[model samples]
Target: MVNHNTQLLSESETTISYANRGLNYGDAVFETLRVSAGKVLFWEDHYFRLMASMRIMRMEIPMTYTPEFLEAEILKTVEAEGQKNKTYRIKLLVWREEGGKYTPTAKDVSFCITTEILENPFYTISGDFYEVELFKDHYVTAGLLSTLKSNNRIINVLGSIYAQENDYANCLLLNDKRQVVEALNGNIFLVNGYKIKTPPLSDGCLNGILRKQIIKILGQVPDYILEEASVSPFELQKADEIFITNTIVGIQPISKYRKKEYGNTVAKELLQKLNVKARLG
Candidate 1:
């Protein structure tokens, strides 16, 4: 128990696959989720997205896999990683493997359940802040793999590298039209006077789990329906405070965007309420 610090799958877990569709043609789908307090939040939604991706790709997966099983795996991984630390992150990866040649085989499946070792503290809007910039060189559109969470993440990797080189925390990615679609990994939320707005899925966004959760949580608050539409760069620049949300980061506020200071504190309050609801939701 002490030796196994985390419960994630390594490439050595399996022998040579049959035809190796996953390795040969990059035919795989996966989900990244957060494990905390011995529970996986919004497991159902993650499953829904995974299944949707599979359906789009004409792949089959075990739909009957219970939430209890997912919880058990996540707990096992968390305990393995955080044996004495008591906190960890989990990444459950499912690969569509064993298909022959370039096409998927009749019946084949393989998976890796890896638990990356956790660090001292996770980043939330409540913690040390970060800033972003409007990236110029690279962009992502909805036409190619936009609806699927495939193994292709080269765009995000390049964008992150560019941000790091520029001494920024993250990069706010826009489409060809240069409108605010999302962050490299998460979805963006712009705060105006008593209103919250985000880019619609039509604007080429990932439709993150936390993004949906935030909208669901905020939609019940009477005045705030948390609408989504095409959010332009001009409108985004005028925002009070901008925040991004995804699985691991939870929620993070941008103190500045490309040296432009957004002096609004609503992100802090929204994050506080969001954390409370996430814990109790």
Candidate 2:
């Protein structure tokens, strides 16, 4: 089931127009949310981020779109799918109304909510070996627009194909300046000793929800120092640990990058704290 502009419909009945702007021009912004026990984890952050992304894309914010209203709609869709009591992954997509080429015919927007069940209710570290390689074929332009979760992801799509062809679990994307921006799917963090480094939003990494949570968690701890700085490719070989973060995975520790292998000491510690925060919320 899916919610199209607050109207619940089965997958077969939910029909998007042939000329839908989102499908035609990639003019859309979306938020991926994790819900557990019928509550959205980090709801406030996700809501604000969605609003911000819509604003950045110049999409009109409907008068009816409010924190409470959107949250209710999301939960309604989840319940309709019979996932009200189960852990689920929900995607809320907002797109401009059909009609336009490069310029939109109207600023008015439409939204859809969809859900899928997740295997775990809380975040857990995977014991499987995960490896990544650099995708140097393209570069993410460093700017504010790159930080938005809009539907401009050709680089990510290409990088995923490259990773698969090369037998790597994932690929690290670089900005025009040759600095490691992030992994294809999420934000990247490098841990060296007690210091942790993640690229700032200015470096073109997605303003990830889990990245913010991890930063807040690290700030409260006296042992580790967190830095919102650029990550160089050279640092990858020297880092003691590397972890990728997103709404779905929470924290995925990268096991290998070429011949260099990483440990999950910090990643494990942070995941425990993250789960605690999620439960408390």
Candidate 3:
């Protein structure tokens, strides 16, 4: 097996402590980044979201953890593994330093960068659609925390397990009100001709970076309008098409939900737009 270590500096190595708040109490925020040719995709957006999450959790952002600084660290970690020329997914973890499980002595934060190899630098729309089902094991609570991707992710963990056990490619999560929130790992979008509907941050959906990008791209189209609203499973089942978006996969089309089948008409166009935008940058 290959050895992978969490890097703190270019030449230094460190390991998480037994008292780390992130380990014991899930007190951390992380960004799953895509790296192609040594450059991070949507770096500024990811950096700002990480900062926002830290502030929301009352953890001080280290002055040295600026976007440019962190980007260099990510590249260093990738190059260390001799994978700088290849595509991969890197996780940037920012956590509160050693502290009591429930209460902390200080708000200081620390970070680590880890990488995983990916097969492709750009998303390739799969010819077959994703299989999905509803996950009712838990309902996400709508609040400030719901909008951030924190370490407390037992809900998604369990949802993923359910999907695998049932042989599903993905599962939909619902908020407490029984409204569709998102997929196990990505944001959900429903297409109906010229309109698109997705759960809003107010509906307990994470403010995913790709979700923002998709909405921005759709807004630029004169004939399309993307609306963030509360969605129900019934509405999802009735949509003309359904797709999920995440950093790794720009757009994943859903083929079947229950007895209804969906087509990829809109997903194809959006995927093209996303790829073009990514390449132009």
Candidate 4:
């Protein structure tokens, strides 16, 4: 089932025109959310981020897009597919109405909601051999627009293809300044002894939902110190541990980067706290 502008439709009935702005010009912003047992995890964070992204892109905000209203619409889409009782990955996309060329004729927008099943209902640490390499073929621009979750991600698509061809689990992206920004799919965090560091949004990393949660979780833990600062490629080799955070995976520890291997002791501890936070929410 798919929810198109509050209307429910089957997969076969759901259709998009070629003139759609989102499809033609990449004029869209989206949120990837986790729904477990009919509840959206960290919904407030997701909702606010979506609203902010839309505002940044100059997309018209619908008067009816209150947090409560959007949440109900997302749950409605999940229920329509009989996934209200299970863990599901939901994507809510908002795009400008089709019109004009580079200049849109209207500020009005449209939306869609889609869902897929997820294996885990809460955060978990995987022991698989995950490795990553730097994707230097392209660089993300360092600015406010680069932080928005808009559908202008040719760099990510190319990095994913590079990772696949090189037999790597993931790839880290860099900004035009050549600073390590984030992973292809999510935000990156590096751990060294008691210090934990992740690139700030100014560095061009996505303002990830799970990244915010983990930052909060780390703040309450006196055992480790968290820093929202710039990260360089040289630091990746010296870090004691490396982990990536996103809405879907929660936290994924990188096992190797080049010849340097990492341990998951901190990743495991945080995964437990993350699960607790999810359940309490």
User: What is the per-residue lDDT of model 3 for residues 1-281, given as tens digits with 9 covering 90 to 100?
Assistant: 11122333432444457888889888889999898987788888998999899889999877877777888778877887775789888888888888665888866787777778899888778987578999998999987898898988999999999999998988999999999999988998999989999998998899999999899899888888888889988897789999999999888999988888899989898888888887766
Worst 10 residues of 2 by lDDT: 77-86
lDDT of 4 by residue, 144-246 (tens): 9888888899999999999999999999999999999999999988999999999999988899999999999999999999999999899999999999999
Q: Using alpha carbons, what is the TM-score of model 1?
A: 0.84
lDDT (C-alpha) at residue 171 in model 1: 90
Model 3: CA > 4 A from native? 1-14
Ranking by lDDT: 2, 4, 3, 1
- Say which prediction, candidate 1 or candidate 2, comes out ahead on lDDT: 2
Clashes of each: 7, 0, 0, 0
- Per-residue accuracy of model 2 over 1-281 as CA lDDT, tens digit each: 79999899999897878988888988999999999999999999999999999988888899899999999999998888764789999999999998778888887899999998999999999899999999999999999999999888999999999999989999999999999999999999999998999999998899999999999999999999999999999999999999999999999999999999999999999999999999998
lDDT (10s digit) by residue, model 1, range 1-281? 21121335444553545666666676777788765565565778887887777777677666444566655666665665546354455566556656456655655455556565445234355455577888778777855366467776778889999989988889988887777788888899998877889888877888688888888778776655477888888886788878888888777788887556675476665566667765664
Candidate 1's error at 243, in angstroms?
0.7
Give the TM-scores of the predictions, in the order they appear: 0.84, 0.98, 0.94, 0.98
TM-score of candidate 3 against the unseen true structure = 0.94
lDDT of 3 at 130: 74
